[model samples]
Target: MKALLKRGFNLLDSLFSRAFTPAWNPLYQLGALSFFYFWIVAVTGVYLFIFFETSISGAYSSIEQITHGQWYIGGVMRSFHRYASAAMGICVTLHVLREFAMDRYSGPRWFSWVSGIPLLWLLFASAIGGYWLVWDQQAQYIAILTAEWFDALPIMVDPMASLFLNESTLSDRFFSLLVFLHIGIPLALLLGMFIHIKRVTAPRSNPARGLAAGTLLAMLAVSLWRPALSQAPANLDMAVTEVGLDWVFLNPYPLINSWGPGNTWVLLVGLSTVLCLLPWMPSRRPKRTPVAVVDPDNCNGCGWCLADCPYEAVSMKEHDFKKGHKQSVVDPDLCVSCGICAGACPSSSPFRHVDELTTGISIPELHIKELLARTEASLAKLSTDQPRIMLYGCDHGSVVPDIQSSTVAAISMPCAALVPPAFVDYVLRQDLAEGVLISGCCEGDCFHRLGNTWVDQRFSMERMPVLRTRVPRERVRLRWLGAQGTRALQREVVEFQRELAEAPALIDLEDVSSG
Candidate 1:
């Protein structure tokens, strides 16, 4: 099932990439787009509230006035509020599904996945409350159905639906209560949104400026084309047999009608429970996942690991052996076992003279020494007569083995970021490979969240452990082709080989060492 969904997402991503570019692709920016739509909903909701009436008798008339009298501004605001809310729901749902399809909602990511479930309910509640405030026939139908739905719960002794039994039973107080809830629930949803991204190192809560502007313009065009208008005023004496519905929020009403309120409640609760437990449903972890380990002897309290970790798993504390100094600590529970911290550690340099070649921070299973040995072995197998290229890829991105050839060698890491910059320099200086190609997850859609970003920054000399300025920039290439980008990776490798063929010979390392 997951494989099928991932393929579908890859196909969509490829199509969207051509239209919006990878950086501005809506699929990649789903989470941020949700935030964008939410702000639109909030700003327009505030404007609508300023002119809203809280009484049942006045609510419908005020809405009618806003729809017709202030058609240019208030009417547009109302439509923006309605449509933006719907867009938010759609974005949130896609964000969840995309995360699941990519298998990112497990292990250390479980907290984000679990925290997001409550947000769906809160969003629906807020939208439903807003509909009721319109006090139209559609709202009337929603109110009565919602009341009956609640009455099915075991905790409700008094039938809440009885409040709408007759024209005299309903009160303005009930209308005011709905107004309060509509405001309060969204505020709560905002808080949940914060908690959802708290563990992420640097969460992107806003989409690109171009994407944001485009979305807003599209929403405006929609509002202008089909302005949101209310139906006739609610009448308890008349039966609500038919009325227009916003399926985004009122989708469950059909289920409630077809499967009884009790059955619908059961279905909703069961679905929520399943989503919350998905992270642990089958356990995606390996038999033994290796976490980053600190070598206090080599550690100088640099704090690079703490900064590079996508999860807040690394911290600093007073060193036990070196008094007054600090050492890095890894929280076992929070660590996702990504080797990005290993790459960030300056001590991970391949030039280290020590026999064991230990680093300040390194993954236990794939230490710096083991990585260098693997790189050397892989390069040794390549033909030196040709333009040898060392291709480094991550487990979650391009399939490295598929692109290996007599002249091109491949090394797969837990993440491309795990390849220390020094390794790239070492490979060139030793003439092991004429060029080094680093490929990983698609731009803006890293499976480990920040792996590819950190790799790019390090290579560009914008971050710590910078790639040496002496090294030829043309010899090092970084391509962010996604997991399904095997063919793309092959094409990039061939292109890099051609570029290296035309470039001048590598610098003389022997002369530099003697100088």
Candidate 2:
């Protein structure tokens, strides 16, 4: 089932990737787009609130007035609010499913997946309450079904159905409570969203400016084309024969109507339980790799590695060794072992003697010293006359094409961010390779969360252990691509080789002869 889900997701992703530039791909920016829609809902909702009346007698009338009298502003705002809410629901659902399809919910990632479950419920509850404020036939239908469901549960002593037993049963106070929930639940949802992304370092909460503007413009066109209107004033005594529904948020209403409230509750509870528990389900796999560790003696207490850590796994504490200099410590539970911290450490340079080459923070399996040895061996096999190009790639990213050419060699790291900047310097200065090509996960879609970002910063000299100015910047090239972008990556590398051949040689042949 998981394999099928992954295949389905990949098909959609491929279609989107081909149709739109990778930077603007909707599949890659689901979470960001969802947040963008939420902002639209929040802004327009505040505008509608000024005209909305909370009294039970006036609620339906005020909505009708806004839908007609203030059609230009209030009416458009109403449609924007409704449509954005629907968009948010669709985007969030897809985001959850995509995370599941990719198997990103297990082990160290369980916190985000679990926190997102409550967020889903909060969004549903908030949307349901928003419908109640419209006071339409659809709203009446929802309230009736919801009251019936509440009554089905044994927690409440008095049946909630009694509130809808007669038209008079719903007082102004009842309308006020509904207003409070409509406004309050969304406020709570904002907090839930913060919690949802708490584990992520530097979360991109909004889509790029161009994509955001396009989305809002599209929503505006929709609003003007078919403005949202309230249905005939909700008459509790009359049956609802015809009602419009925003399928995104109201999809379950049909099931509730057919299955009855008890069965609907059972279905909802069962599905939510299954979703929440998915991360812990047993899988036939080997034991997990050990998390990153901090070498206190090697650490200079610079604290750069701690800041670079994506999962907040590293922290600094004072040590007596260097007259109260801080030492780094790693929290095994929080570290995802991406090795960005290792790359960030000033001590990660491979220029030291072989036995002494180590970093302040290192992943047990793929430390810098091990990477240095592998790189030396790979470079040794390449012919000296060839314009040898070394490609450093992320394991989870685009496959480094298995080139039949004699000039190029590829090495895969746990993530591109794991490649210490000094390795690039060593390869270039030591004449091991004429040029280095760095590739990783696509921009905004890194598998290890911050691998691409950190690596970019390092190369640009904006982070610790930065690629030095002495290395000719023209000789190094970076490309970000998705797993399916193998052909694209190969084309870029071929271009890089062509450019490297055209440029004058920077390596000193006399130094190579003497060594």
Candidate 3:
């Protein structure tokens, strides 16, 4: 089932990528777009609120005045409010579906998926309350059915539907409740949105500037092309036989009306429960990598490891042995075991003796010492005569292109971010290989989030654990490729080798020991 859904999503992704370049693909920016749409709805909603009257008698006419009286600004605001709400509904639904399809709702990601479910309910209720404020035929249909749906529960003394039987039965108090819900539900949704992205290292609530501008323009075009107007004022005396519905939020109403309130409740509750439990539904749980461990003996209290940890799993505290220095502490539960902290530690330089190369922070499975040993072992197998090149590949990305020739050898790391800048310098300085090619999951699509991005920044000397300036830039090349782009990676590697051969200059090895 997961594979089939992923295939469908991939097709949609391809279409969007073709229409708007991959950088601006709406499919990839669903979460950010949903947040952007909320801003649009909020701004337009404020404009409508200035002139909106909440009482039963005034609600309908006031909305009509806003729709037709001031067609230039007020009408546009109303249209924007309506269309942006619909766009948010679409964006949030697609975002949820895409996360589920990719199995991102499982394991450590369950918190985000579960938090978002209640956000969906809050958005639906908020939109429904907005509809009621219009007090039109469509709103009337929704109000009646909605009241009936709620009255299905036995707890209510008088069915909510009883309030709408006649004009005398309804009051401003009821409309006040509608207005309260319209404002209150969205406030709750804002809180839920925060919780939804709480686990992410750096949540991208806002999209690229270009994408934002494009979306706003598209919304404007849609609003101007087909202006939103209120239906005929709601009349209690007349029956609503025919009315246009905003199916996005009103979808459940038809099911409730057709299948009866009891079945509708059953369907909604059952679906929500299943979605909430999706994380544990799979037969087998994914294996988690070993978390980082702090070595107090080697720790100098420099705190560089704490600064580099993306998950906030590393904390700095007073150390017993080093009075003035602070030691790094690891929170096992919060760590994703990316091994970036080890790379950030200055002691991770492999130029030191094998026994002395330990870092203050290191992953249990891929310690710096173990990594150094593995790298040397891999290099030992390669012959010295041919145009030798060391290939560094990411475990989560493309299958390391198997260079069958004796000229090249590859080493795969758990993540591209795990490769320290000194490790690259060590390989070059020791003449383990002629050139090094660092490859990983593409810049925007890292499996371990910012792994590839950080790797690029580190090598470019824009971030910590930077590749020193003395290292010849021409001897090192970085490539970002997705899992399906092994062919491109191979081509780039070959090209890099040719470039290295043409230059054939070595980096200064004397300065590497100082790092």
Q: What is the C-alpha RMSD of each candidate to the true structure, in Å?
A: 1.8, 2.8, 3.3
lDDT of 2 by residue, 248-290 (tens): 8878888878888789889988999988888877772224778
Q: What is the lDDT of residue 496 in candidate 1?
A: 87
- Which wins on TM-score, candidate 1 or candidate 2? 1
Model 3: ten consecutive residues of lowest lDDT: 504-513
Q: In model 2, which regions exceed 4 Å deviation? A: 7-24, 284-287, 353-355, 401-405, 508-515
As for candidate 3, its clashing pairs are none
RMSD of 2: 2.8
Query: How much is 46 displaced in model 3, in angstroms?
Result: 0.6
The TM-score between candidate 3 and the true structure equals 0.90
TM-score for candidate 1, residues paired by index: 0.97
Which portions of model 3 show Cα errors greater than 4 Å? 8-28, 282-284, 353-356, 383-386, 401-405, 507-515
Evaluate residue 274 in candidate 2 and report its C-alpha lDDT on the 0 to 100 scale. Answer: 87
lDDT of 1 at 197: 92
Number of backbone collisions per candidate: 0, 0, 0
Return whichever of 2 and 3 wins on lDDT. Answer: 2
lDDT by residue (413-455, candidate 3, tens digit) is: 6677788899889888888877888887655656666777778
Best by TM-score: 1
